[model samples]
Target: MNTSRGYLVIGGLVLAEAALLFVPVAILGAAINWPESLDFAPSQALPLIDGQLGQVRLGYGIYLVYSLAWVLIGPAIAWLALGRDKQVGPLFVVAVGLICAWALARAIGIIRWLTASTFLAETYAAATPEMRQTIDLIQSSVNAWGGAIGEILGVSLFTVGWLVVVSLIILRNGGLPRILGWSGLFVAPILASPVIELFGMEASIFISTLSIHLWLFAAGFMMVGMALFGKEA
Candidate 1:
């Protein structure tokens, strides 16, 4: 329960969480894109999609299971590393709240993506020329409004909430350098904003997401290193 050992445990858990992200990303990405490939040629990819969906669902479920581990274990680890005198109660409460909000936002985003993708594929395939024109109008309306709502509320809430909560933890605990935490906070608002207006024009989902993942990985490492190296201070 010394600082060094505490850090190592938390750091290891963080890395494990990062590593687990790849499972669902790989599986779900394949599942989402699999149907598109079916149009190119007669192939076995359709079945693969079905199979991947099962895997993705299972992987996502597992991910959710472990989501609480870090937050719960982290404070305890941090307490031991930096010493029991540190006031980590607020940090713990914030972390838990952020995790819950993130989980809810993620659920909303996934539902939106799945619903939109399925509707587009089914509706587009079945429509006659006249129906297609009508449906196109509907689609435009839906996308314009629905997409805005989903992006703004679902995605933004999760991303920004995560950035703020994680940054606060680091800043409060003095676990990692303050600059990285500040940088994360700065990036959060950009990631949360719509990618159309001038302020949000330069935003790239890929870059933003990748950067967040990298920060999590680094934070995890820092936690583990502190646990394994630091004395009770």
Candidate 2:
């Protein structure tokens, strides 16, 4: 494809990524209160999941697909960055690796919601008292581990690391506008800030997540503009 077409494809992919994110957010937020619901104890959460099993399946299943798309997006972003600066060979590999790792980790984390959590929720409703205790313990462990992998590692660490690396490349190469790079750099830290919550500290998780969406929207539009205007900065 020609340069313009190539950029248009990547830009479309980026915007689609932003749009995909909204689907699960809206579905889960409406269905079960989602991220907050994730904090509920098993006694509280399982019943809710069992009650709205259909929505849980739909929301988390879509989320899994969205996370997997990150693998494709990593290469698309790397291609754009390479167009600006071909010298970032090793870093390019690392960035793509991080994105793929994030994708896999995210899938691992979300799979439980669609599969194990559902099973446990269904069983929890009919289990004996002893079995209920067992289910509760299992649910707690599952959520803790899954949350760490998906939220801390995939969402915060790998995502921020990829953005920081790509933003630096953008800044150094002067391929696109420098402001786009700086905007990404600014949002990267905000994304990372939520990781501090693991240490029992208060963090603005909602704001941090909103920042990610904003950055994606801004970056998507900028790329689409570059495609239309055929600008190579």
Candidate 3:
């Protein structure tokens, strides 16, 4: 029932979720390589060129679970922080919105990857002349799916916008460090810009993407936990 303790519990849960989510990345990396001896061209393995179908499936599943956790618990933590303060109410709303946007984007990305990968892999195995043409059609469909995902990424810029706003709220309320708050504000535009340029541009901005999201998630967990359980400084 202690406030700081609640924050710590939330933080611990986020960290634990992150660790579990990260494992699938390693698993996918290790299991994803295809054997050259398989003699199937990349086109044949459309779903996953190497024995990566299983890995993709597993990774996407893990991502889904973690994404859901973030969407649900993230708002609960934010509510805990902001609900009592009338000034913080807007920030809580922003946090909830951003978390929802991120969750939706993540879900779309997972589905796109799974569907495209599976279709390609199945078509690759059937490589008859007729199947080849069908494969081409499927490939086009996959490309369209990619475009759709790009749109989702673009729309998801709201996540960064909300984070920046929430960071400011946290700083103003004196619950978290000013440095982190400033970083979140500064990082938002950089993280959000890639969504607009994603179609034609290389997504190198995802470096910032990783940085911002990780920081927000970690900081939210720690700050909330401490607020819930820790003694005042």
Candidate 4:
């Protein structure tokens, strides 16, 4: 029973990842765009409340909280997949660590927005002109440090490092399909995205966001399917 339950626990994590991809899908269903501009710089913090969340807590707050969920848990699926086969290696361990960093920094960005930015939004409409200065300063600092640097670097490590490493191992070492192996490699922009972003290609941010989430959905389901089939095998 203990053995059976262990697999079940890992499987649930993957399933959770797959489900979170639909958070955006559901957004589209409701005629909302993906929260593209929500990554507001500090100067643009006021819009977080008025712009994205649309002057309501329930609107944007729920989305950020949902993001924090998968960002925090999605990386663990990789480790659980490796452990399921009892094939733990130093390289894969390193990959998992990068994923953890990716998840953590992204979550912190969201948390900062939820806490500090939302506070700004809630007070913006009511604050005196003199009070706006203090609010803007705090928002600017947090937005720059928290969102711009932290999330960007975390994603850079994830896209350039872990995705490549995991894909290579899956293709050459794991006994998976050659096409899926090849497909995994296509997910990251190899020589572009992360590297080019350093020189200033902001579009890469959107690309990475879409690509990474899709990768999570794909990777998660692959592990869950493997785990289930392996159980019967």
Score each candidate by Cα lDDT: 0.54, 0.85, 0.60, 0.57
- Structural similarity to truth (TM-score) of each candidate: 0.61, 0.94, 0.76, 0.69
| Residue pairs with backbone atoms closer than 3 Å in model 4 (clashes) | none
- Model 2 lDDT tens row, 1-233: 77778778888898999899889989998888887898899999999999999999999999999999999987686667666445667777888889999898889999989988999999999999999999999999998898889888888899889888888777777655678789999999899986997898877767887888888777778878989988976
Candidate 2 local lDDT, residue 216: 76
Quality of model 4 by C-alpha lDDT: 0.57
Q: At residue 14, what lDDT does model 3 achieve?
A: 56
Count of clashing pairs, candidate 3: 14
Clashing pairs in 2: 175-233
For model 3, give the RMSD to the true fold.
4.5
Model 1 residue 134 lDDT? 66
| lDDT assessment of candidate 1 | 0.54
Give a tens-digit lDDT track for model 1, residues 1-233: 65466567667876787777666566555565522432332123323433455554565455455444445543443343233456657655665565555555455444533455345445556567787666556645554454344445544665466567656665666556566578778777767654453354534555555665687687676666555666322
lDDT for 159 in candidate 1 is 48
Best by TM-score: 2
Q: Point out the higher-scoring one by TM-score: 3 or 4.
A: 3
Model 3: per-residue Cα lDDT over 72-135, one tens digit each = 6657645544523435566678788877877776677556656765667665676787887777
